[model samples]
Target: MSASYAIADCLTMLGRNLKRLRRYPSLTVMLLAVPIVFLLLFVYVFGETLGAGLGDAGRAGYLRYVLPGIVLMTVASGAQGTAIAVATDLTQGIIARFRTMAIFRPAILTGHVVGAVLQTMLIVVAVVAVAVLIGFRSGASVWEWLAATGLVALTAFAMTWLSVAMGLVSKTVEGASNLPLPLVFLPFLGSGFVPTGSMPTALRWFAEYQPFTPIMETLRGLLLGTAIGHHGAGAVAWCLALSALGYAWARRSFNRERS
Candidate 1:
């Protein structure tokens, strides 16, 4: 009964929000468009400027090198939308109104998170389709490909929860929306584009230890059908640890919002 009640409340909230999309259809299009533009900008405009090393290695190799960065970008984009939507709700006293209702109080926010997750899944699909259309195919088996995509999706889910926490804590929409930038930057310093050994010592140290590299390493390995070179265990651990951390923080924020 409790689970059903929570789900229904969330779905109802999701339905209402979906309907609101028709008010300005461009809003949803913009969410999908920004990332596609980035893909083009990086893969074409700056592709040569970034250097020949990544490209000389073949299109597949280039995609392999930059895949993690793109994955991070997609999730970051989704999370930003999640935070903004949540902030909008809080700003307009929609949350306060819901508090007065008899339905599950927490379900309102949970609903938003669920809706964000669904949106993120859609973003992932669109990204992969665009990627494949651009010759970003993985030579791995079908199952391996699914595993790789699933790993990235898992990271996105954890990130969406973290954004929910940001939405609950930030004082303004700008604060809420842009908070994902730091998280998104993590992959850049890691082994996402270049090997950690090639980086300066300080950066190398950070890259070797930062959660992004391992996640990227893991995803790359899965996508390429290779084993994560050295930090495979650490990468898997970071995902679990980060998810737990994000969940704990989000739950605290959720509780505090009610208080």
Candidate 2:
């Protein structure tokens, strides 16, 4: 297809997925609810205790520290829904039908990625609004805010592609749902909930080197005005590498299944 035609085709498929999302408002609400609940639970329930460990920073400081991590965690949680949706389409033979059509092959995956990214962005905004209501604040300038938004969008795009790969490889919807759980929990292993320095030697090393740590650190810096150091570059690298890997795997698996 020509470039414009390809773009149009992807947009048309994206609209179809979005309509499905609209028809299942309850699913979307549930997907969004988990992160909001976690945000409230951590900020209120665990904030004071966790903040106490930071000495003078206190619970309020902890809120600022953890918001970036929670935002990423929300994206990770939404990835599971993307995986499940893809798996459902496959199991229901929707993808097979699409493959038999005259449409651009990649457009199917592009539609899923675009639709999921948009949905995840909406959820992130809602979570951020809730965070603000509960006293979360950021000192980020307009440029910093734009940069942070771009990072979040990159993260969402990478994770959505990874989720698509997971869905393509899974035998069933339940399996697809289960596969992306690790993405949601990966933040906890990094610097999301607490500083890595406080952990034991091996765990701390792993935490510091993991993908989520740099991304979380970069976000913390952009939003809270903390030092970004090398993390900004690290986060970009990780997102690009993962996106490439996921896209390759997803396309290969999709073609294999269709064949």
Candidate 3:
């Protein structure tokens, strides 16, 4: 297929997915509530204790510290919705109907991925807005804010692809919905809520080395003007690796003959 033709087909699929998102607002509301709830709970309930530990201004400091992780969690939490959407399409005979059409085959998957990324980014903006309203201040300049947004979009892209693959392989929508839970909770195991140095040696090791740690650290550096050091490179590497793996896996599964 010509590149333009494939692009057109992808756009069509993207429209379909977006319309579905609008038609069913409950899923988006549920996906969005999780991060906001966590954001509020941590900042209000644990902020004073955690901020004292960091030797910063009480709740205000904790808000800044936790916002980046909450932003990331926003992206990860959206994965469940994406997986469920993909699974629904796969199981509903939509894929078979599309296969018989003249549209580019990959557009079906591409639509879901693009639509998910857009939805996730929108939630990211909402989450950041809520954070700012709740005393989460940032020292990032316009350029730094732009960079942080780019990094977030990249993270969302990688995560949505992985969720697409998960959805493709699942036998049921429930399984697809459950498959991405690990992604949602991964931040807790990282430096998301607290400094990794405070954890036990083993956990600290894992927290420091995991992909989300570097990604969170990079976001902190960009938004709060902390030291990014090697984390910028590490975050980019992890995003690229995950995107490639997910794309390959999703394509393979999507193209396989259905029994």
Candidate 4:
């Protein structure tokens, strides 16, 4: 089929999955609450204690500084849910049924990825809103805000693809459930909570050089409307590279399952 037709079919499948997800109202509510809990816990508990130089700014400024990372953590955590849901479909043989339908070979997988992205986007937005209510503000213009949101959505998209691949590969629900933690751990190694300068020499260098630091730096800069950090270019490159790698891997895995 033509690419356009395939995309359309995928979108239709995406809508169906969205409905399926929405049917679990309690799950949806829980998903919404997860970020809120994290936002409160960290903002209240460690916000003041987190950074050395943080002031009236108080926990509030520091909270703004940390919001993007929390947003990312929120996305990372939600993708584990995606992995579990996908694994459920696989273990129950629904994935096999969908494969047989021949609607579009990759459509079902696309649907799941799209839905995960949508779910994470909503989660991110809700978390951001919560941040605002708790005293976050942005002086960014329409375009800057759009750019920041785009980066977040794209970051979530890459993560969702990674989750899809994990779901496909994992034999057990627990395997799928636990897979995301390691990926999430990588960010904490960077400038997410602490300044890279404060870390040990080797760790500071590594943390400053990693993907999440730059991405976080970029988001913080753009959202908070500061300059991209020293490593911003590297971060953008890393994100795009990761997204490409994730897309290719997910496509390969889906094709293998179909075959």
How are the candidates ranked when ordered by lDDT, highest leading?
3, 2, 4, 1
After superposing candidate 2, which stretches have Cα over 4 Å from the reference?
Answer: none
Candidate 4's residue-wise lDDT over 62-147, tens digit each? 88888877877777787788888788888889889987775786887889889988888887888888899988888888998898
Worst 10 residues of 1 by lDDT: 46-55
lDDT of 3 at 185: 84
Is 1 or 3 the stronger prediction by lDDT? 3
Off by over 4 Å in 4: 2-5
**TM-score of the candidate numbered 2?**
0.98
Worst 10 residues of 4 by lDDT: 49-58
Against the true structure, what is each candidate's TM-score? Answer: 0.88, 0.98, 0.98, 0.91
lDDT of each: 0.74, 0.92, 0.92, 0.80
Better of 2 and 4 by TM-score: 2
Q: Candidate 3: which pairs clash?
A: none
Model 3: per-residue Cα lDDT over 1-259, one tens digit each: 9999999999999999999999999999998898999999999999999989998668898999998899889999898899999999989989889999998989999999999999999999999999989877887899999999999999999999999999999989999999999998889999999999999999999999988999999999999998999999999999999999999989889888343
Query: Whose lDDT is higher: candidate 1's or candidate 2's?
Result: 2
Tens digit of per-residue lDDT, candidate 1, span 86-193: 888888888888888877776776677667777777876787688778877676888777776777767777777888888888888888878877875676788866
lDDT of 2 at 64: 87
Model 3 weakest lDDT span, ten residues long: 250-259
Winner on TM-score (1 vs 3)? 3
